[model samples]
Target: MVSSFSLFISLILLSLAKGIQGATFTVVNRCQSTIWPGILANAGSQPLDSTGFELPSGETRTFQAPPSWSGRFWGRTGCQFDPSTNQGTCLTGDCGSNQIECNGQNAKPPATLAEFTVAPAGGQDYYDVSLVDGYNLPIVVEPMGGSGGTCSSTGCVTDLNRRCPSELRVGSGAACNSACEAFGTPEYCCSGEFGSPDTCKPSRYSEMFKSACPRAYSYAYDDASSTFTCSGADYMITFCPSSTSQKSANVGPLSISATTGSDNGPTESGDGPLGINTSWLPNFVTGSSSSPIPSSSSWTWPFMIASAYLLFSSF
Candidate 1:
């Protein structure tokens, strides 16, 4: 019974993790011994699915989320070619052709190394902007503020006080406020539910982390009842333990008081069989404009124990 219960708990945690992201890890063996054959046999498998690989008692090395064996994980570089057919390869250099063309739908243009520039017209009432970007791909510049930007707007993010710049809007603020409130304030943007954050924000957050920690995997966990937290050092220089930790509740735990017999404090518990159950406040993260990662929250060991108990009871 205990084993089954433990298995159930493990399954719950694993399931929750899968809902967030799917990845693989590859463990390699550097030892020169056959002491453990089957253990480290397929250590270099694709998807890096396993947590750890067996080793023959030597310096074993492994990587999380190793490149997919089937080539399906082509990533940004894979977009240039069909991974399923092309196998595992990158189309980095030129395509050996000049007058290149891109077909509709799944067509990709060849790669190039070029420079580009965009300048305003000189000594005239017109602008003659030049374009260069190695690839020389056509560039599009739109007036975000409905073409009202005049490069003279005051206290406005854009040229005109009409709209916020795309950078401020968070990749075309089709939602949310464009104004990045005083540097440290949460930039509330528009969402499908109006006056809420959007999925695009998280995607942008992922991009920021990738830029900051290119090698390490980045995860943004939000339990609604808990605050937004991260898994790194105070400045990203040192590494924090990858294992999960506790996060304090903005509103502390409930405590029973003898006073009203029905009410204690804001977070106090009461002994009334017929009384309503007051819920704890939902956890939240005050996101910042400059950083993609929200503030970190530290959890307590006691809370973790209680959580484990609650989950076990449910099972």
Candidate 2:
């Protein structure tokens, strides 16, 4: 009878352990240069391993996220930091935190973003790679292993920076600006008169982004095709996935591995991820604009005690 009680307790503990296991995110840098990936947890959400970290060319790192986690991730380019003061800046996607770690800050405009909200109550994990802020690097979010529902991969596979319109270009052709960022008008920003889906329609500039990457969020109201759903899955985020060879010709084969949490935040190397030593590319289009851009469960300890007593009494 004592052995039976011990076995039951062990089983309960094991079940609890499985229930608390969080989803893992494996971030990969396929660019020829190094990228400092920044993370920002949503308000009231638990934090992850680190707010930011440096990912060298062709290197991959993994971090875990609690169930029901919600956050955004972006790559910083042309960054330089001072360790002593924890102050620094990046040419693109800078969070203006004055430190390597973002410290719960979101990235500035004209940056690519990967957003996620994982459900804990056995619901679908909602994710999307968004160019609504603009585009710097091509990104892909792939599911490692999960069952049920459509766990389809989503990303901006096309190189939008090289093809960005002249008016919406930023920082030595390293990044592209969204219509709303370049021109802060209500039309482009979906504000004032154009606040709702009915009021705001897709502009030519937003259409350009949608045309390039149909699976991504091209504008503020792009939800139908942009958002994706998956359940109980690990994700792989790859930066510069398409142009891996174009920039780093001599880079070695990509290596992937899982890693435990670390304290080292993102830092800059000599060359920036966007400063690819390639020929200058021509511009693409024109635009007019301006401005802008969890569940629970229940259980009772008294019920558990009553159930245990009943089982032991039966024995």
Candidate 3:
């Protein structure tokens, strides 16, 4: 019977090419204005293909995701909407989803996440770029071709709404609120019992957002260095990422030197560490890593996994 129906349609196209071979997420923006990005897909992943759109300022937008697939992405700043019922609203990551498509809705915090998971069979693909639900703008997450050795690049291209903190600014500045949205209690909203992490620790406005985005994820257990990993990767996700300087005329406050680990330089500290008052950080905004995840020894990935298992046993 025609070679068993062409080996059952080539074994169903190699099992749908293993979910289209997972990962590939591009999403640049380089910001000058025009934002709207949003995505959600987490609790039981699978939803990629526009969960929101409109990029504009230097556009970019690629997609695809299937293997483990987890998500979270943000960027919505100052929107308007309403070109005939497209509804509107957004001054910062709004995912109340009036229209721009955040169908599964999520980002509605001070907003500035990236988060990912991927990796199912090729394994290892965590990622990060959160501001612990606060910090509207500046994101990074590079990782390409990924194959371990830690596949680097994480973000927070620091423009911290011009150093917010006249009580988490937000209006004249546009976004920067998250001392648990300006002091809601439970000690900056770790919650109820300061909810673990051995009872909420970091806070001086999350150590000045961890001294200006030191690998993002500033508060909420921070996860060691704000988690990062890669293996069989492919992700770009830039936003105000050209390596800092997203408009700054020195908004003020920055005696710096909050001391803590190293990224090769500055880490001093004096009247800091919760003693607060490092002027308020007029600079620190670090981010610079994008090269690693190269190590490959040959046999072309075991000869393409034994030629896809002998073409799925000759289908």
Candidate 4:
């Protein structure tokens, strides 16, 4: 009897160690500040733009998978805060000099930055998951501040190589009131008053006057504007485990480019706007691990198989 009991105990222990399942899952909280419920019209001209939704303090938005949906999840499509609006626009507001406008009021803000299991149901070993802006636009992952250096004029152009001619100019289609900031490549600056010619201040005041006007355009620096320096911009980061053993990591690190102005880089394929194609992938993930899940448990075969089986079975 004793021998039989020992054998049975050993078999149970072996089964628990080998066939017992563990999971490697993922939790993602694609948190961002770009998704405002109401249209952020031309609030740029008002202090409210700097302090309100146009650029609220500590305000954040998130995108997540709904309760009834399953499959490769995505959200925050073309997430943008328009600064202008036309007639018949129901949802109207302001960003500053511009008026916020939208066609409807049912626009949902992006989901909150959350960590949902990506591996399997009821398993703690989650895949490393993170929230990202659609097309990974930096503006969406990490939005520009009301005083973002990107829109600042009179700031430094750190990379002289990328700088447009000191005397570059734009056409009437992009009027002076809307003329590009002399601080950055001759791109349109967010102006105080619309429909007039605006000129960037001479190089002398580039640093002194940057960020003075919340909605104005200026150059970005690594240090002081006068010093032609700036710190990196902050990123909205949220991480979840790949396994029960992994811990969550949520951070909003400021990521500085070699220089500012990359935000305004031309599009890769289309002439849609004056900025780069950043709506798909964020710039911060450039050299980091690009796996969809966030933990180390995903490497185990049993966990992988179990997770796949469970996920497939649900479908």
Candidate 5:
């Protein structure tokens, strides 16, 4: 009887361990100002903990993502939220939900986005720090302790807002607007006749963003260079990651494999790479939900297993 009970307990623990296998995202705000980190899971996917939360400067928070999770994350600046009404707005990267938690809402463009698709096909995590929406903050996505395939750190380390074109500038040195956002033309927005990569060529405006951040998506068609793949890795998303002037510059150690030679060099149009075809995947819908399911569901099985183990031992 004792042997059978021990075997059952062992099986339960093993199942519990397997259930928790997934990726963790450590979000850090290294900026001198406060930032509210926002998360938007892909439509029909399980949401993570608190879609948005206030992250004071120099603070860090970690959240787990279930297997095959896909989403985008951005930092919101200058926000004021009220718990009573659950309504508010942010100066930059606002989801316009009138609340702290985005609750499945996507950020308005002109905000830098850290996009991710974990455990996608081929067992690799595809990720990128995209400026295609535009630029608001200096963000970095560093993969930590992952095996298989080159896990390179990708982000816009340079402050694009400082060098934004006069016409494409948003606020007084706040965020840089994408050419699409600035002009809204078919050529700039990559819509209508110019939707294809051959038609919608890189403009001089996008070149500025590409020059500043080669590893990030400067436009909608940028994929080959910007998309990085890593297997079984936790990611660190840092906003305003440590500049030389700050004492708390060293947040943590990072390991980056060198980018593939195919996409490393600059192109004729100043885009990171050329000759890469653009393939359209099913798009994730961006909207809002009132109540999202909690992420604590993963822990329930473990708790129940522990209780069962204790009960079996007592016998």
Candidate 6:
């Protein structure tokens, strides 16, 4: 009985960790206008259904990715394309493919991005909504029909395009630029001495972003609370997700109490979660925005432990 139980427990653990081998990503365009969505698989990962496509308002599409696959998804705005020859230009998030499909091309700057790394067998998939590149629109990645706990929803549900600082704002406020993309400094870009987590620090501009979207990656090193994990779950990637008029809830383990525009507290250029004074920022860098970023609630350790307890109790 003991041997049989041990083998059964091991099998159950593997299933819990791997989530039925792969995952399905459902992309929904909830924006007011039509937007072009782009996809790019990581170097070694298999391709999804389409590299790029037109998602009209209120339309929904889905893609399936194999286990161990990794890639990014983003949206392009103000696009004018010719389906006949598959050519066009976008005001933001263009993959530079000059056509409808990204064809392995990555999204250009000023694009809100959703990234994922589906786990191989016996592993937990990782996902995040990043502002490391910049923000073109609001987005939310909700894990579908899975056990709760750390497997919760995440993403930037705010229209950061409107609140974008003047210097970082793209033409007509179509997208917002990250400080790193705007300045290209080692400090803002988290390169050189600032490359490591210990040396890098968030700039005032990044603080402003953190203030607006508390759960997103405000800067390059914003990792502790920026990444999430899950097993055996599908995802709903919603573009222009409804903007919530509230500050994000406090982080569970990190105890990060962040405030947003809706909250009655500090504004962008003031003290918030970082505990760093945000009185001033360098003169904003003016130019076209460049590409990339990360979210979440808990680590997988607890989930595994919970699974173990449940399995043992059943035994």
Tell me the number of clashing residue pairs for each predicted model.
18, 7, 3, 71, 2, 10
* Regions of candidate 1 where Cα sits further than 4 Å from its true position: 1-47, 50-79, 83-88, 92-302, 305-315
- List TM-score per model, in order: 0.15, 0.73, 0.32, 0.19, 0.72, 0.73
Error of 1 at 306 (Å): 2.9
Model 6: per-residue Cα lDDT over 1-315, one tens digit each: 676577567756654543544777888887888999999999999789899999999888888788889999999999999868979999999999999999999999878899998887656778888999999988778775445335666677666665676778788778889988888899989999889988887777777777656667888888776788876667778886652312334422122234322332235775544332223121101011420000111334455566567666776
What is candidate 1's lDDT per residue for 210-299, written digit by digit as tens?
222221121222112111121111111000111111121232212222232132112246212212122211111101233222212122
lDDT at position 3, candidate 4: 52
**What's the lDDT for all of these models?**
0.21, 0.71, 0.72, 0.24, 0.72, 0.73
TM-score of 6: 0.73
Report the CA-based lDDT of candidate 1 relative to the real structure. Answer: 0.21
Please provide, for model 2 over 146-262, each residue's C-alpha lDDT reduced to its tens digit, 9 standing for 90 to 100: 546667677775666666778888866788888899999999899999999998877777776765566789889989878988776677787876554245444321111123122
Q: State the lDDT of candidate 3 residue by residue for 23-105, as single tens digits.
A: 77888887898898988999888788889988998778888788899988888988999888888888788889788998998
* Lowest summed lDDT window (length 10), candidate 2: 279-288
Winner on lDDT (1 vs 5):
5
Clashes of 6: 10
The per-residue C-alpha lDDT of model 1 at residue 129 equals: 11
Minimal lDDT window, size 10, model 4: 129-138
- The reply for model 3, stretches above 4 Å from the true place, is 1-20, 24-48, 51-63, 66-72, 75-84, 94-134, 137-147, 151-163, 172-174, 177-213, 217-229, 233-315
lDDT of 4 at 134: 7
lDDT of 1 at 220: 22
- Cα error, candidate 4, residue 136 (Å): 20
